[model samples]
Target: MKLYNDTNAFGLVSRANHWISAFLFIGLIALGIYMHELPKSPEKFELYDLHKSLGIGLFVLMMLRLVWLKISPNPEQISHNRFEHILAHSVKGILYLAMIMMPISGWIMSNSGGHEVAFFNLFTLPNLVGENETVHEIAEGIHGTMGPLMILVIALHIAGALKHHLIYKDNTLKRMLGKK
Candidate 1:
């Protein structure tokens, strides 16, 4: 297996980033959902802090993933025609936007709510937006509204992978899995 992308397959690094981002994104969403329901308490606040920190980490990962995507060679589609290609590209574009934007909106909400994001408790990120209730509400609206939608897009992405693997029996999914 190659360590870098070629025409037919994704490289190890891309696969690594993709999988890691997926895992973290799922975990963060789950945590966010659960955290919102918890009663006011120390543990709840701690959980919120952790969630915020993980979100900031996700933002960092998105940046690095974007950089890696730009530097790496583009992988080719297995058997996509114009329509399928366009659909796949559209889904991917939206997914990328969600990945980048969700964390940012969350961060904006945090800062607007007068919260400092501590990345893994290592250091506190600067409060960029400060305390703005209107901004906080808007950001929270975006964050909450987009979360479920992103999950739906994620499901579609997975369905596409399954279609490629089970129905088409192509290496499309395997290529992303770093398989030959």
Candidate 2:
């Protein structure tokens, strides 16, 4: 199968990216939740460090995906219904927004907390903002609160995919499943 989208369906690369991102997104949420629940200790701090690393990795992957999407043509519109098309597009847009914002907020929070952010222990990310207790608190609040919202939106996205695959029995989901 092709790895780039053409006119009929998603390419293998697109499907691969989607599934990889889905798994990573879920893992990130779980890690974030676990870190939040853990008592303040060395272990908690370690987990947070790993979480920060994963966030950086995710951000890089998302940037690559965005560039790929811009250059690779998308699958043809499967639904002619205006409402369905609008809903689909809206969900995609929101998903993209979440993907972009989540990492940024996390990075900002870390910077404001005077923490060094690293990616896979290979390279350090320079702090983009200066340390400020108030800014740190606000950024942390946003990062924590946005977690549940991300989960909700992800659930909706998955539900919509299932609706297309099982209920509607359309190619909409299959297109992203690497089916022609």
TM-score of each: 0.94, 0.93
Question: What tens-digit string does per-residue lDDT give for candidate 2 at 54-77?
Answer: 888788889989899898967766
* Clash pairs, model 1 backbone: none
Poorest lDDT segment (10 consecutive residues) of candidate 2: 73-82
Candidate 1 lDDT, tens digit per residue, 1-180? 567777777888888888988898888888998989999999999999888877877788889888887888668766557877787888989988988889888889999998877887789877779899999999999999888888888888899899999998999888887776
Q: Give model 2's TM-score versus the native structure.
A: 0.93
Query: Which residue ranges in model 1 land beyond 4 Å of their true spot?
Result: none
Model 1 RMSD, rounded to 1 decimal: 1.3
**What is the Cα-based lDDT of residue 133 in candidate 2?**
92
- State the displacement of the C-alpha of residue 11, model 2, in Å, after optimal TM-score superposition: 1.1
